[model samples]
Target: MLTFTNMRRVARRAVLFCLGGMILTACSGKHEGAARYRTNCGICHHGGEGMKGEIPPLIGRIDLIAATAEGRHYLADVLLNGLNGPLDIRGVHYNFSMPSFRNRLSDHEIASILTYLAARGDSARPPVFTAEEIAALRAHPLPPSAVADERRRLDGIHRLP
Candidate 1:
């Protein structure tokens, strides 16, 4: 009792529904931080690895430096005021410069970016990075030299809070 046209229409509807479902499923799995990180940080981090050693890799190693509150502050400072000069990352000294995003990105965006990084490096729950924390550093943004100095300080004190 069914016409061929009706059968074709039904088949097309089923196919369209399946396609829509697949698209929705794929989109639902993407993380907000991961997306923003990809847009902003990924250009350099490249999924946590600096391409061809031009930038130091941050994958799986952030926990060592970010274990304490001081370390966290150091990180926020670096993000707020870009880092320049030589850095010894896991024995390999990288002298590449990281530009500051203080002017370009808001404190919240920076926090979101860091949150993504924390999740990546720790594989645990994201750190509680508040805007107040970012604002505290806003009063006097450090230069890359100062950031490097802080890095040295971390090395000296063993990065304790």
Candidate 2:
């Protein structure tokens, strides 16, 4: 014989508990994904430390590169096919070849990395690259027609000191 007041209290408590559980679950998932990035991608990325003149920083340059359509397309292509030579970011030159993860990583893994980068890293606009998108990129690989020339062209853009 529970009163209406007690029922309301129980229901409220149940709702609160459910909400807290959901929040904790979401946080844990994010943490796990970030840890994966550190284990896998961190080898080359290195959080932009000790990579100043080699690899491009993934943190603050997201806004500069992800803001426009061309930049986004370039990023997508790079992820799929990998880019070689020098990349100029905000007047700084990064000379390194970004290797493709197509064969090494699964589509889901790539999607998760992109999602994490877009959500947590610095990007002008958040990206939503799905597993399906990765599949499509794989299906139609970027042509290797002028990769060398493109690299040279990018090098030209770098300010010579």
The candidate scoring highest on lDDT is 1
Q: lDDT by residue for model 2 over 1-161, one digit each (tens)?
A: 89999999999999999999999976765665466567767888875342667666776554344555445445556666777765566566777676777677777677666666656655545665567766876786764334435435443654212
| lDDT for residue 120 in candidate 1, whole number 0-100 | 67
* Tens digits of lDDT, candidate 1, 1-161: 78999999999999999999998854443365567678877899899877544788866656555667888798889889999888777667678799888897778777766766676665465464666788888778788899988888887988321
Look at candidate 1 and tell me the lDDT of residue 38.
Answer: 85
Using TM-score as the measure, the top candidate is: 1
Clashes of 1: 0
Candidate 2, residue 150: CA error in Å? 8.9
User: Which runs of model 1 end up more than 4 angstroms from their true locations?
Assistant: 1-30, 123-126, 159-161
User: All candidates' TM-scores?
Assistant: 0.73, 0.68
Q: What is the lDDT of residue 108 in candidate 2?
A: 67
